[model samples]
Target: MPKRKADSVLEGVPKLPRDSSIAHHTQADYIEVNSFVTATPCDHCLDSGVPCMIDRSRRYSKCASCTRASRVCKREFYTGREWDLLRRAEDKLSSDIEKNEDELDLLEPELSALQSRLTELY
Candidate 1:
């Protein structure tokens, strides 16, 4: 028995012509897969009392540590200045709420009196 030529074995296969249009495409033609990742670790790491060593190459919201721990990853972390501002805002809101509660307490009796008067009028 004689060995078959490689060309004869591939003779049954249909060949497609090289696409010149594909060669014309540049890098810009392809969609970028990697997203912009932040260097900072997620809130879970901070809350867990662990160092936030984020692996930016993964391009995931959760860091590798957090992912392994099966925890939710939150990116929001306040700086010292932001925390101070937030505390001030919270104090103001609490004062406003107390004032509103006092005003509501004062108005409750007056409202009851008005409702009683309306009932008598009707």
Candidate 2:
């Protein structure tokens, strides 16, 4: 049997293209794969006592360590000074909503009283 030549070129790197002798691996590919990994657990996971090591694949799963509906990793969106600003905005909106609800609650009886008075006047 004649000796095959392709085997010798692919001997070192298994995934390298068989047609071409060049390998196309890049540092970015390794970094992208490791993007979901964290040296420490996310704060939500840690605070909840689960200390979740969130993987990108598992972020959308029901068993994710964080309770947030957002699929985005908290580190990506809710980190640094931007996170602090988001928290402040959330708190303000919550306060405003509660205040409006309370005002509506207070208006209900008054509206009923005015309706009853109008019924009597009519």
Candidate 3:
């Protein structure tokens, strides 16, 4: 087949730099969600450096120190296989977190009972 002419490129859309660490301007919500990976703390505890604590008995902000609330952690292109693996890992982590939350909910009443029993004993 003969070679075809290239189509027009987008204007003013600068190429992405190889530096993943470059800071870019974005709106408030977007900026809050994405930053240099090392600089962002657990979106959950807001720099507590601890994974967020979840109690079934308590209300949780969507910002729970869970991976779902965390950063995407990638800036460059990827192979299809690599992307599949990354997505699977992310999904597994998300499920694990949900499972932990469910377990906490299931145990809340038992914890309450134990606290009451201790009070009575004291």
Candidate 4:
């Protein structure tokens, strides 16, 4: 393929110095942008069923909704795989609880009989 010509608009702009403060500021800006991009909604926003909109101007801050409501912003960002694992664990626990409840129900008559015998002895 033939070489492409550079944009005229960018030709006049001077290259940034490697060790300059401007470069450092640019790095910091990148960090801020990455944080904003990767950040998930806070717990309150998730529970309230609202969109999590973080203020681009503020770094490491609460979502706009939480800020407006004056609520504590607690974030727990979980990946899709992590959420799936958590849900699976919860389902297992729920199944165990149901089994235990059924066992308890089956033992209720026996428990009543034992109590009645104890009462007679008393």
lDDT of each: 0.60, 0.54, 0.49, 0.68
lDDT of 2 by residue, 1-122 (tens): 32678767667675744432221123223333533545455556555665354435542322243333233335433446777898999999999999999999999999999999999999
Give me the runs in candidate 4 sitting further than 4 Å from their true place: 1-76
TM-score of each: 0.46, 0.39, 0.38, 0.42
Report the C-alpha lDDT of model 1 over 7-107, residue by residue, as the tens digit.
Answer: 77778688753454332222112212332334444777566666554443554445545545545667766677888999999999999999999999999
Among the numbered candidates, top TM-score falls to 1
Worst 10 residues of 4 by lDDT: 30-39
lDDT at 107, model 1 = 100
Error of 1 at 12 (Å): 41
38-75: candidate 3 lDDT, tens digit per residue: 22334435545553333233332222334233443222
The model with the greater TM-score, 1 or 4, is: 1
Of 2 and 3, the candidate ranking higher by TM-score = 2
Best of the candidates, lDDT: 4
**Residue-level lDDT for 77 in candidate 1:** 61
10 residues in a row with least lDDT, candidate 2:
19-28
* Candidate with better lDDT, 2 vs 3: 2
